[model samples]
Structures are given as C-alpha cells and as structure tokens.
Target: MADAPQTMVIVGGGLAGAKAAETLRAEGFTGRVILLAEEREHPYERPPLSKGYLAGNSAREKVFVHDPTWYAANDVELHLGVTVDRIDRQAREVHLADDGVLGWSRLLLATGASPRTLDVPGAELGGIHYLRRLPDADRLRATLRTLGRENGTLLVVGAGWIGLEVAAAARAYGAEVTVVEPMATPLAVALGPELGRFFAQLHQDHGVRFHFGASVTSFEGQDGMVLAAHTDDGEEFPAHAVVVGIGAAPNTGLAAAAGLELATGPGEGGGVAVDGSLRTSDPLIHAAGDVASAEHPLFGRRFRVEHWANALNGGPAAARAMLGQEVVYDRVPYFFSDQYELGMEYSGYAAPGDYARVVLRGDAGRREFIAFWQADDGRVLAAMNVNIWDVTAPLQALIRSRRPVDPDRLADPGVPLTEL
Candidate 1:
C-alpha cells in the first residue's frame, strides 16, 4: 500500500486560506502545505479597501495580513496569480488554469466572493466601478485623486457596507455624494428598519443625499462615460461617476460544478452548504468566509454572513474542524462600518421577522444609543449600537452563552451591561 499522502492544498489565498495554513502550522502539522492565490500579491486585508485605503490614509504595505518572510520561513509554498480551474475529488488533485495540477491529501476551499453585477443598461460604460479586490481600490483612489472635490459628483448605487464606506470616502474628499437604494432605508435587511433609518440620518447629516426606495432604471451616457442615471420613478440626475455596491454573490461556481451540495433558498445567496462544524458534504473539503453557508447555533438556522468578523473568526473554526476535531463554528455575528462621523457596530444575529421586541439604551439624539432585538421569549437576539462599544462585549457573551437578560434592565442606559 502507498504511504498516506502528507501534502495539503489550500485554494484561494484570502484571509480564510491564509489563516487555515497558519492554523495548521500552529497545530504542529509540519507537512507540505501549498497556498494558491489568484492575485499576484500576497494575501492582504480587504476591509480597508472601501474605507481607509480608498481615502489614501492607509498604505498598501500596511494592509497585508503577514509579511512575505513569514510565509517563506513557515514553509508555505505560495502560488501567486495561479487560478485553480478544476478540482478532481476522486483523484485528490486541483487543476490550475496555468496547466498545472497539485495533488493533496486534504483540500480547503476558501475562494471568497465577487461583487454582484448590475444588469441595467450602460453598465459597460466608463467611470463606473465596483470595489472588491485591491486593484479595484487602486482604480477608485486614482479617480478620487484626479477628480478632487469640486468636480466629484459620485453616484453610489446600493446602501450596503461597501457603498456607504465609499460614499464616506468621497464625501471626505469633498465630493458631492448621492446614494440610491430600492429599500425603504439603508441596510434594512441587515440592520432592521429602525436602525437602518438611523444610519440614513447619519449619512444625511454628513451632506450625503440618499434616494431611499429608489431604483435605477438605466444609465444614460455618451462616449463610454456615464452622465446620468434614470430612476424608476421617472427622475434623472447628473452624475460624474457611478459605483455599484448592490452586494455580492458567492463565487461558488467551482464548488457547484464539482457537485458539492449547496444551500438553496432566500438567504443562501449561492453558497456551499456546511454543517455546524463547517464541514461540507465531502468531509475532505471545508469552506469558510463569505462563500460558506454556516449553521449558527444562536440563530438556529444556516446563513451566509459577509463580514470581516465572520472571515476572521470562521476561518480558524473551519481550520480546526478540518484537522479531525469536530468544532462548532459559532461566533456572535459581528460587523462594523465607519462612515462620516459615526461608527456603527452590531452583534448577534437578526433575521427578518425575528425580533419581537426592540429595547433602546442611551440617547439617539446624542448619537450614542444601543438597540437590542429580543425574541418572543424575551431573549436578546441581536443588538446594534452607535458609538457604544461598552455594550457589545457583554451582549456578545450573552448571545454566545444563551443567557437571558431582563429586557427592562437592558433598555436602561444607566444600568450597566454587567447587570444582565
């Protein structure tokens, strides 16, 4: 019999893939590990692309997760700019786009997502952009620097995190920013209507115009440069540049083509199905980050969360599960967005039609408040706070520990979160 294979192959060098390799080494695997990255550069942090990086406040080197020496010294073979085109499950081989094949004893799929496209007319026009990879941010930064503040009329479509962050950056550059969203409020699906409204107000206060409940019907342009956008309400507005941030669809075509079981339904969003332990139907394969639909113990359902926290925490959890120890990948779903003068942070999980009661702590008028979502059983389901970081740690612990707190006490700002 052949000796058991010792090589491990990791596809996609995003945060999840890099962390998995680091975790494996930390666990004393000491085997041959290969990390395949489609990008030429090493794995770098992405959250800043839409924020500090876009504003040119963060240098490129500062965004990288680790130095090149770390990967070299750790004996991780990094394949930069090499795309994995096919996975042969039976053969235990990954076929690269460059006509190369890598054999492995175990495989991990950390292929992150790409930005969802706008199917509307004039999408191919110039002066239109989408923020995802490092290259995308570079293009946006160039545009911002060239346009400066006076001539900068940025039309941002969608009110998700990326869109909002870009808007914040544009406004900070003294650009006139306008955001269009089909929903009643920005981030309604994620932050709920009430908190979403607060976010809308926050942006409006920073001189950003928001077209709530508005959809872009088409874009009108000449010479491949977008000039204006027509709305479904029969309105037109001039725009110098356009950004589409409608959200993202998981890059799961490779997994789906390999016959991996995918979670289907409204919230799955085209992602691979994984159990509580973040294991796919094929035990040899594991997934993390935005591409993996993981089961949440607190929410009691499977969902895909596209957030920096999810990628940072879920990556390690999936790595642990892949190492033969079954571990529940449960972390209070957390996300933060810095836009204008307000810093928004949220913890726990909240789905549509889930919150039975919402308790407000602190003063919203003063721009410091905490909104708690409670289930019908009066248990806290999720919480959002504006400039209130003190409540997050306790609330996160409560959600993870499944501890019920008194709703009345939670509603009072004077009562310390520890009282729960």
Candidate 2:
C-alpha cells in the first residue's frame, strides 16, 4: 500500500468525530477517512437528549450531524458498532474488537464521555437510567410517558445540567420530580453560589422538590427494580423511576491503555493531555472534545469541556493540527441550557474560588439577567446571560479582553458590554 495515499482513522463517532471528518475534506485531504463509531446510529448531538428529544418535542432524526449519504458522498467510511480495543502506537495501528487491524498515518480520538454511575446496592435495578446517549434518552422518555403526569415519582440523583434539564422535562410531563444534590447549591462550581441558589428557586417555583446537601445511601427496589432512594440523612424518597446525572467520566480507557499522557494532579481535569493544538504526546495522534483535557493559551490552563460548542469547534482544530497546521485550540469555552421558559448562555472559564465578585445587570428573580464574575483585579472571569440574545459576541469579548472594568459599569443596563 506504499503507492496509496495515507489513511486517517478516527475513533468515536460523535459530534467531534463528525466535525473532524468534515474539516479534513473541507481542507482538501484526499486520503481515505474512516470513522469508527461504537453506537449503531450516525454521529449525533446529545444536547437535545434531555430536553426536546426526551420531552417528545423533537424528532429523533434531527439530532444527527449528518445523514447516511453524507459519509459515503464525502468518501468517508463510517463503521458502526465497532470498538478499538487497543492503540498500537509503535505499529501505528489500531486493533479492533473483532480482531481486525487498521493502519493509520494519523488518528483522532473523539471518544467523548460516559455518564458517571451511582455506586449503590440497588443501582442495577430496572427502573434506573442515565442520559448520555440516544438509547438512554429513548428509554427514559418511554418511562416518563408510561408513568404519566399523575402517576409516579421521578427522583433525580444530581442537580447538574443533565439532572436539572431532565427534571424540568419530567416535570413538564406532569411527573412528580425531586432533585437530590450533595452540594448545597446547584451548579455552584460553574455559576457560583448566588446564581446556583437562583436556579434552585427557579426549579422550586415550578414545583420541583429539592434535597440539598443530601447523599443517597442506596436505592431500594423490588424484583430487580428501583422503588425508592434512601438518603444518608435517614430520609427515604419514593420513586417509580430514578435518573442519575451526577457527571461524566471522559472516555480515555483506550488512550490510557496505550500509555498516552493524562492530566493528573492539581487543577488538571482528568482526560487525555494534549497541547494547545490538540496534538497528544505522540506526534501522529490527536484528541478532541470531551476526551481531551487540552491546554488553552488564552485561559492559561487546561480544561476538559463536555459541551456541544467545544465539540463543534474542537474537532476542526484537532483535524487541522493533525494536518501539521499551526493552530491553537483557544476558543472561549461556551455552553447554554434551557429549562422551563428560561434560556441561558455562558462563556469563559471559572474554577472554584477563581473569582472574587459577582455582578448582575438585571433582575435574577425576573429571570432576565446577565451575571458576570470578576477577579479582585476586576478582570472578567466569566459571564452568563439568561433570556438574553445576540449579546454573546460582546460577552465573549469582555471575557477574552481580560480588561479590568468597574463593577458599576458592568452592572449598569445602559452601558453596553462591549463599551466596558
């Protein structure tokens, strides 16, 4: 095969994988492109899984990044339900689960992440679910429909994004919803305590129950089905079905098995370590999306973001880096969520204890607001806009500029974000 152009193999058929393949072709790569997907479906987005899709407001086919014909039209081989068992870096090959081997000139890891599981006695029960994939969402949707709005209880194990979104959707279907968060406030690490409390109130106002600072000791079930959740505080929350959305664990097993670099120790999010350009330790290998804890020159830190924006953009950046292009995976991290009637967008990075102040431009109770986090020096650390539109560009600039601005000016509705 010396006469043939080099082949590029990409693992993980998700948003990142789809974008990488698209970028390679758009950038004029004439070589063979192969996408190995563990799921039977085509590359799709997971954001809608808990909201529109699970709530029955969205069509299933709309979640996919591309239809079946797109891959074949682009001359990309899309292999469904195939797993890469090992990465032979020395041989520049990947061993498949079916005992097949594939040689590659370059490899991209877009393995994404898996939902973190709860370790409890009755966790394996039939009425328990996690929402990370389409199938998971489908099952949850079916259960919610069967329970009906007047029927059973939906006990959510966490108040993170997925958990909160699922709670909202379940509530919309008229199911009784209760969220249990070990943290006193929901999304505290991202939005800080005050805003997290605001979300707690928002959910409560809509009739969602909360058990803050409580840990689930175990789930109680009958005949291999979860019936109730018992808390460490000796409280029992009865449920017809339970959905756990604690968080996600990056899918880095294959990379770890291949002795690839991982982000370990202080401030490093756990995932495969990659340089600014998304190139892994091996020159021929790269990683992107949820699986890559990549360094960002702009943020001056490494982060593993599991949002749609990161995957939508990170995939292209990794593909360009795989082509030996001088690039930086330095886009301002962004993500958004919709619950009930509230729609919010957040940009920039903020770690726990990273910012010293929080300023608001509108009423938190009114649900029309822009919240900004600033360091002691007044440099904007992060910004979130709820029920706001067309302000993300300016909001992103405010964060990227790193300019020290007066808190008064930031909170004043008359002063535009860009002017600040």
The number of the candidate with the highest lDDT is 2
Report lDDT per candidate: 0.85, 0.92
- List candidate 2 segments past 4 Å from native: 1-4
Alpha-carbon shift of residue 123 in model 1 (angstroms): 0.6
Q: What's the distance in Å from true for residue 201, model 1?
A: 1.0
Per-prediction TM-score: 0.96, 0.98
Report the alpha-carbon TM-score of model 2 versus the true structure.
0.98
Cα error, candidate 1, residue 33 (Å):
1.0
- For model 2, which pairs clash? 149-174
Candidate 2 lDDT tens digits, 1-420: 466697889999999999999999999999999999999989999998988899889999989998889999999999999989999999999999999999999999999999889998888889999999999988999988877655789999999999899988888888999999999999877787989999999999989999999999899988888889999998999999999998899999999999999988577779999999999988899999999998989888887888999999999999998888999878999999999999999999888888898999998878999999899999998999999899999999988899999999999999977798
Model 1 error, position 417 (Å): 1.0
TM-score of 1: 0.96
